[model samples]
Each structure stands twice: as structure tokens, then as C-alpha cells.
Target: MTSSLQRAAFAGTYDDESLCGSGLMVVRAEAEAVAALAGRIDAYFAAACKLILACNGRVVVTGMGKSGHIGGKIAATLASTGTPAFFVHPGEASHGDFGMITAQDVVLALSNSGETPEILAILHLIKRLDVPLISMTGNPKSTLARQSQVHIDTSVREEACPLGLAPTSSTTATLAMGDALSVALLEARGFTREDFAFAHPGGSLGRRLLTRIQDIMHTGPEIPSVPETALVRDAVLEMTAKKLGMTAVVDGRYRVLGIFTDGDLRRLFEKAGDIHTTPINEVMTRFCTRVSPELLAAESVRIMEEKRISALLVVDDDNRLIGALNMHDLLRAGVV
Candidate 1:
């Protein structure tokens, strides 16, 4: 940050330290809790991963209270990261949601205390179905852990809550553990960006990765172009009509020969070239940058920014002009 911005940002902090100390302590405790989890990535963690990977069905995550909330987020992360998973509240599981779990699926249950009655109520049914069980709990000797095929200990030294009654450090540690598992499984499955984009196709990130040049490029009459024999004025009229700030100088076969952009026009005018009489081929840039219609829209953005150009011409394998697009097209498509 600039010095002035730094001063403005810290202007009130010198006097508020007393009021902020409590929040600082809470953050520190949670940070320590997350830090301590690095050591717990042991054989038990591997066992859980193996069990989930071997399952042919989705992972069913269940928990009570705060753990349930954590489980829901964990399931979402897992689902988006390549693992097929869903959260089923323990309280709901005992009622009728137990039907969600199947013999082909793996059960990932969360209970900080290792003994949530609702979770315990369905324990017998899980075993009867012969489904593999993975439990994450603070107590290794708890009923949930004792029966689980694999147990992951997510214990924190203490709660961040000063009263030691609220779930804070424990929940943070659980979330970190969930993220660790999610990313590990993501890498193990060889998940690619396209795979991630397929799961998330509603946002800018999805548009950037999934959108292709063909999807947004202007085709047919929308492309700005003029034959090499045309005057600079003709190219200017074409560029203005297409509103792409540039025009392609093509041959009689509609093959791209060069590009005439706003920058080229400015340079030509500096040299006192006549826009109405000068041949476009003489002033246009030769061997202009071209892109494949199948290329990712995000990659096109990278190319445009690197080359410091606003427009790109698309061509076929035979070098025929197929489409055109500019930075504005990308912006409107949300690929920028």
C-alpha cells in the first residue's frame, strides 16, 4: 500500500488494541489449532482417503450442530473438487434420511465429542449395511471412533471461546482438515481445471475456462474485413461498421493477409498518408496474430494482454478468415 493509504488504514488501530485484543486472541488460538493439524496427516488419513476412493457411490457426511454446518461445507467442497458427496444431518438421518446412505457408499461422520445420540442411533444400521465408515472426532476412544473403519482425530488444544463452552477452535480445525482432504483427493484424482469449470459454470471463472473463442467470436457478416486492393478509407469504413476498432485485410479468397488497427491508422496519418487513396495492404501489419476458434477464451485474453492488442482474428486450418473478436467482446461475455 502507499504510505498515505497505510496511514489511513492504521489510523484507528493504535488506540483500539485494547478493544481488539480479545478478537486477536481468538484468531491466534484458531490459527494455532489449524497449525497443529499438519501432524495429523498420518496413516489414518491415508486410510480414510483409500476407503472413500474405493467406494463406488457418493460419500455421505453426517454431523450434529456446528459439526453439521461444517459437514455441509465439506460436502460442497468435496463435490466441487471431484468427489461425489452430500451432507445428511445426523438428527435427520435417524428419522428417514438414513435412506440416503447405501452399501456402495462410504459414511463420513463428524462428532467432536464422538457421541452424538442421533449419530449413534443410526450406527447399527450403517454397520448392518456393510458400508465402510470414516469418523472424525476429538476423542479416539469414543463409540463413533471405536467402530469406524478409519478414525481421524481433529482435536484442538482448547476452545478459542474463553468460556470453553462454544465450538470455535475445534470447528476451524475441522474445516482445515476438510480442505486438506478435498485438495489431496482433488490431486489424487488428477482433477483438471476443465473438470472444475464443468462443476462451476455459473460465474466469471466458469465463463473464462469453459467459454471458447467460437462461442463469442463474431462470424459471417459481423467480421470487419476489406480486400488488399481496398483503400485505407474502405478499411476505416469496415472497422467503423463492425465497431471492433480494426479490420482484416484479406485476399480475394477471404484469407487473412494482415490487420489494420487504430494504431496503424494513427501511424499512417503521422506519415501524411492519404486515407482515401493509400492501399490498405501497404499500411496494414503483415502476418497478424491469429487464434483458433477452439482455444479457451481466457487464453485469448492472456494473448491479447501480452501482445498489447485489443482485437484478434480467427482463421481456419486453410487460413481462411472465420471470425473476429475484440477485448470488448470478451468483457461482454465475462471472459475478461
Candidate 2:
């Protein structure tokens, strides 16, 4: 019971094959453009990395229009990956922003045609300051390319745009070139995960790599623990009071002997045992998973997931209970 208008509204589109073909064509074109850059990583690319590595001041990246957007991202990637870099709009460079650049700084300029007016306008200033210039462009003979100390060829065979007007494949080629530079610098500087974590402290990768169990675990009286001689009722009371759904059964030295959880209660209920009179040690899970306070919170998450457990008892080298945490803590700390 479908109306003709409803069917037309839902299904009246261009041919599916044509739409899919267009998308595939664009993707293939961009892939080819990126692939073509592999062979162009010659001595000039290595020299560019050396210049940035030897630079004492920050890298100043500039471009016009769409190239500017790509330049900003490239600068961000470089700064986060160990190189100190920032973006400057080519138009703004003519203004007072040009003061941000110094003789020690390296300039990375991008333009598909290699003749953007704004970029060209600032070339004389860069020359006067004696700053190293690296140009990424499609035209090798363009003024910007010829003037640069290191010229990267980011030429694309054709535009992904069917009209051959919009900068689609050319922009992709430029972005890939930027990524290549950043990664080369990153490897050259021996950037580690710890350094990356410091740069991205607010990100999930930082939380996973930098956060330790001691940073987020519940310590002191917040831990729900009872002597192994305690009764099931006492254990249940401790679990309920702490709201951790579990309690660690420890010895007089505070060494973990077993663990009692809500799951134990469910299994106990199936038997005729008296809850109040039963010793927790007789019904508790003897083989319990334990973690150290120094362990990474991300490693704790992996252990919990693999063991199918929600809570873990934090123990010291002597296997004595020092702290405790649950899956909820990890989730709250953004480690999950």
C-alpha cells in the first residue's frame, strides 16, 4: 500500500551505478595522486627534514585559501609530534603577524599553482629575514618553487572534480606531502609514546598510556576488605557498605586469601546453607585476579575484560591488599 509520490520521493535518484562509479573514481584518483608521491621522496625531502630538525625556532607554515586549511592541520601535526610549529595566514603575514617569524624559523609554504598572490607577497619578507623556505606546489617552474631552498613537487595528474576546477586531487597530494614531512621529523627526533602522551594529555591515548592504577584506585578506608574468618553476613555487610559489589577476604597481615562477591551470594542461595553462620572462606572464590598499584589503568582494563570480572584487588609485592578498583572507576577516569 505505497503511494506513487512516496515511492518517487524515496527512490527517485540518479542511477545507483552512476553514483557509485563517481565516488569510486574520486577515491581512485586521490589514491593514485598519493601513490605518485612515493617516488618523489628524494634528497630534497631529506634536506627539508634536516632544516626543520636543525631549526632553533618554530616552523612557520603558510598558504592561501584551501591550502591554508591544510597548512594549519600540518602545523598542528608537526607541533604535537615533537616539532614546534605554528600556522600563519599568507594574507596576515603582510600585516604585523610577520613579526612572528624569525631568522631561525623555517617557513613551509603551500600552493597548488605555486603562484598564489598572498604567498608571493610574503616571499620578499622571508628572503630579507634569511629564513629557510620550503615550497610545496604542482608547478616546478613557478616563482615560489624556484625561490624555495627545498621544493616539494605535489603535482596531481587530474582533479577529482569532474569539472577539473576544484582542488580535490591536488589538495590530497599536498596533505600527504605534509604528513610525510611530519612523520620524517618525528622519526628523526626519536619521538616516543610518552612524549606523544605529554603533548596530548587531554586525549584518550594519554589516559591509556599515562594513567596508573595508583592514580585512580580507591585507597585507605574506601577498600572493602574483611578478615578471612569473617562470616558471610559480615562480608555482605562490608560489600553493601562500600557499594563495590565485592569484598576482599584477607589474612591478619592483610594478605589476600580469597574474594567474596555478589555472584557468590547467588550460588549460595541455591544451596541450603545458612547465610549468617557460613564462613566466607568456605564459599568465596579462592582463585582471584590481582593487580599492582603501578600497573597501567589500560592494562587493568584488559585484564578485567579477559577475566570477565568487574572488580580487582590491588596488591603490593608481598600480595598484601593496598587498594582496590572496579570497572566503574576506569570508566569515570576515561580509561575505558
Candidate 3:
């Protein structure tokens, strides 16, 4: 009963079950290839890391075709993770980009087939310059692997492509190997979070690590504060004026004695108390959360979250009020 148009529409269309099975097969094959690499991490890997660490200059990465695309990403990862590296196109190397590579540099080359002509063309130049060469390939006996000081086998049992021609599993294995190398070198170099923050100063992680409490706090007259002797109504006025949801109660020396918030006001209202005539000290919270100016804003966020508070008072070693801040400050500064 199906028309010709309906038959044509279903001819090449895959059922959901077939599509899901095909996708899972590709993922499993690639995962197995990456897992196999764990056993291949030996002394050669250590030597490669040592060579890169000892290099006086950069790590030069080179490859051809699809390998070249993966090489660029690997180079970027290495550079961002404490290793200085860059990608050089094998085709461009013969056209003068080779000058970017120096004897002080270590070359990391990629080629699925060990006989890539563009890469092999530069092997002689690399040797003449006395630069150490590291190769990643599927074929161990290929010319590229034989000429290198270290050979990382990125071989997959079979291509994930149904035709066994397009690169799928092989590229995944190579990229995972690159990540392993970058992370190993990152740890070996003792790279710290601060170093990472410096590299990514504009990112959210950088903001969290580098921003200090003093950098985003409200100081001077912007801080809502009142003398301990002030009335509860006066404290409320200050809080409303500053719109900070709370006010600090301080002694004659400007040392913080307690804090009063809108929540306390609501509790006082339930008791039908004369808040306008009541001393602020009587209703204020005596034990308050305070932080030093040098504390990281990110850590302050954790304190606020743990205590379920929205505002914090910044104080000095002697407990004298220096500044004030609330959740909004952290949010505006992108520290949250």
C-alpha cells in the first residue's frame, strides 16, 4: 500500500536502533584503543618528558593532513599546561617555516603512515640541526619512527569508519595520547594554580583565584555602619541608605561589636517590640562572621554559603572594621 515517494523516503533512512548501535560501536572501539595506551606508557614516555623539560626553547609540533589538525590541538594543550610548544605545518616547513625550529627545541611529529613525504623531507634537516625528534605513528617500523629518539604507538586495531578508510579511532587515540603527555609534564614541572591563573587571566577560574576581598569590598562612607549606642531604627536607616541588607554595630574605636540585619528586624517585629527606641546592641548578633582583607574572594563565597549569610564585614587583626561586602559584590566581580 506504500506509494513510490514513501518507499524512496524509507530506502536510505536508518531506524533508531541501527543508528544507536552504530554510534555505540564507534565509541567502544575508540575507548578500547585509548585504554590500550595505558600499558604502552614506559621508560620511553619518561625520556620524552625529560627531553621536553630540558629543552632550552619550545616544543615544535608537526604533522600532515588530519594528523596536522590533531597536532595543532596537542601543541596548544602543551603550551597552556606549562610546556612551551607550537605547531609547524610539515608542508610549510620546507617553505621556510622550518626556521621556527631551532637546535634548542624538541620536535614532536605526528604521522599515521610513517612515510609522510612532507614530514620525511624535514627529517634530514632536523638531524643536521641536532634537534631531538619524537614521533607518533601507527607503524613502528616506518621511517619516521625509525629516525626518532622516541616512538609512541598510536595504533588502533581497526578504524571506526564502516569503510575502514576515514580516520575516527586513530585520531581519538592520538589526541588522548597528547593529553596524557601534557598532564604528565604539567605535574613534573610543579605547575601551580596561580601559574594557571596567570595564563588565563580573563577566565572565571582566574577571577576566583586572583581576586582579593579588599579588591571588591565597599570602603569608607559606602560601608553601612553605626555606633553600638545607636537605636535599632537608626541601624535600619543606615541599611536602607546603603541598600546592603545589614549594618555593622561598632564601638567608639570603630571595632565591630555586632551586626544587625533585616532578618533580626523581622524577628523583633513578631514580638511587638519598640525597635525605634531599643538600643541596637540589645538585638544585634554578637558573634558575627568576619574576614581579613587579604582573604581570597572565592574563599569568602564558601564562608557565606556555609553560614547561609549574604553579607560579610571585613576587619583587621585588631577586629577594627575596614570594609564590607555582600553576595552581590562577588557576583558582579564574577568571583561566584
Instruction: State TM-scores per candidate.
Output: 0.90, 0.88, 0.89
Clashing pairs in 3: none
Model 2 alpha-carbon drift over 4 Å, by segment = 1-13, 251-255, 318-320
Candidate 2: tens digits of C-alpha lDDT, residues 192-259: 99899999989999999999999999999999999989999999999999999999999999999989
What is each predicted model's overall lDDT from 0 to 1? 0.93, 0.95, 0.94
Q: Which stretches of candidate 1 lie above 4 Å from their native place?
A: 1-15, 203-205
Tens-digit lDDT track of model 1 for 153-196 = 99999999989989999999999999999998999899998899
Of candidate 2, the 10-residue stretch with the lowest lDDT total is 9-18
Top lDDT: which candidate number?
A: 2
lDDT of 3 by residue, 1-336 (tens): 999999988885588998999999999999998998998788888888888999999999999999999999999999988999999999999999999998899999999888999999999999999999998898989999999999989888998898899988898999999999999999999999998887787899899999999999999999999999899999989999999999999999999999999889998999887877999999999999999999999999999999999999999999999999999999999999
Comparing candidate 1 with candidate 2, which one achieves the higher TM-score? 1
What is the Å distance of residue 125 in model 3 from its true position?
3.0
Q: Rank the candidates by TM-score, best first.
A: 1, 3, 2
lDDT of 1 at 230: 96
Kindly give the number of clashing pairs for every candidate: 0, 0, 0
Poorest lDDT segment (10 consecutive residues) of candidate 3 = 6-15
